[model samples]
Target: MDWERFARQMATMAHDLLEQDSVVGTLERIVRSATELVHGCDAAGILLMDGGRVRTLAATEPMVDASDRLQERLQEGPCFDAARLRDGERVYRIENMTVLQQRWPAYAPSARELGIGSMMGFLLFTENENLGALNLYSRLPGRFTETSETAAWVLASHAAVALSSARSHAQMTESVATRHVIGEAMGILMAGHHIAEDTAFNMLRRHSQDRNVKLREVAREVVELGALPRPEQPSRQ
Candidate 1:
């Protein structure tokens, strides 16, 4: 298979998904595109790292999520190993789960019971960070060959970049919102105290230190309370 053509198609799909207004819509598109790109694969799934645990970002079938959850629970499998190692562009394929039992004794029987005869997993990374894995499961042995693995890798890399962009956008949006809230709180403090802006800021800092609270939490309470308590006066000498 010519990877150039596959790359072009995956890029187009990713671009279209990125244009969508919601992350859920984008993930749905990613899994659908991935399943179409790989041959002999009955299902496809994308795993994304969230707070140190991998979650099912999207999947072509519910069974795929179950299989992934098993791996997540077992904490040992091709996908987990690939992500931990940051093996971008790497593919691991096993012909039978029973043979894999020796290496992954916990994962093999459950995977086989789930009707997974062969498995191929591709690691997706962004720059230095390991994002997660794109997995393809097949019910027939020797289902994924070298050519299929390469095609899947091309699709997975583009998907990884798109997913990373979405996550970055979400973080930036949250940060801006937090800043807005803090600014509003500061304005409230300045207006209520009839004090200079710098003084109001210092009061907030002092209160945060004295109360053992976060600056943002203090700001939130000040905004809600509408007036801060008077600071205690030091005793006269």
Candidate 2:
């Protein structure tokens, strides 16, 4: 592959994704485009760790989906090991899945049965945060070579940046919307109760703390349902 041409094409893809302004759409484009760049690999996928489990965030082919499921079900595979490794460590391949079955017996046979004979996985991270892993699979035995490993690393780096950017954009959008809803709810409380702004905010905060619910949720309920139940008065003993 011509490095110059590839770089230019990847740059164009990144620019197009940025222009779309939709996180999910951008991620879908990224995974598909990256699968094309890494040669000889039959499929590509991105796995993300959420709530303590790995889940397929995006995949380019059926083989990729099968590989991801194998890892998810058995909790072991190149991708899982790669993501758990220390920064800069790479799990390039599982030579002889049968012999290696001692380490990940459950994952090896299933992965091999899926027609995945060779694999390369790169840990996806940004600064201190470990996002997950990007995996590539091949049907031929010993399919990934030194050159392919290097290419996988490059693709993984690009994917990390794109995934992080998309996630950050999504979080910012959600935060802004939550703030808007809370502000509107506060206004409603102020008008309905003839209370000062600070008092209304404090009431919401107190309710949120007491119930262990998010401030945004409490505010949303206030706005949507008009009023919350007041704490009942205690009778004199």
- Per lDDT, the best of the predicted structures is 1
Clashes of 1: 0
Q: What is the lDDT of residue 49 in candidate 2?
A: 57
* Segments of candidate 2 deviating more than 4 angstroms: 50-52, 86-88, 95-106, 126-130, 229-237
> Of the candidates shown, which would achieve the greatest TM-score relative to the real structure?
2
Clashing pairs in 1: none
- Residues 99-218, candidate 2, lDDT per residue (tens digit)? 566666788788878877777778876335445777787776666777777776777777667777877888999999999988888888898999998988898999999888899998
Model 1 stretches astray by more than 4 angstroms = 1-8, 22-24, 48-54, 86-89, 98-102, 126-131, 207-214, 221-237
Candidate 1 residue 181 C-alpha distance from true site, Å: 0.8
TM-score, candidate number 2 = 0.84
Model 1 Cα lDDT, one tens digit per residue, 162-210: 7777777877887887677667778998898788878888888889899
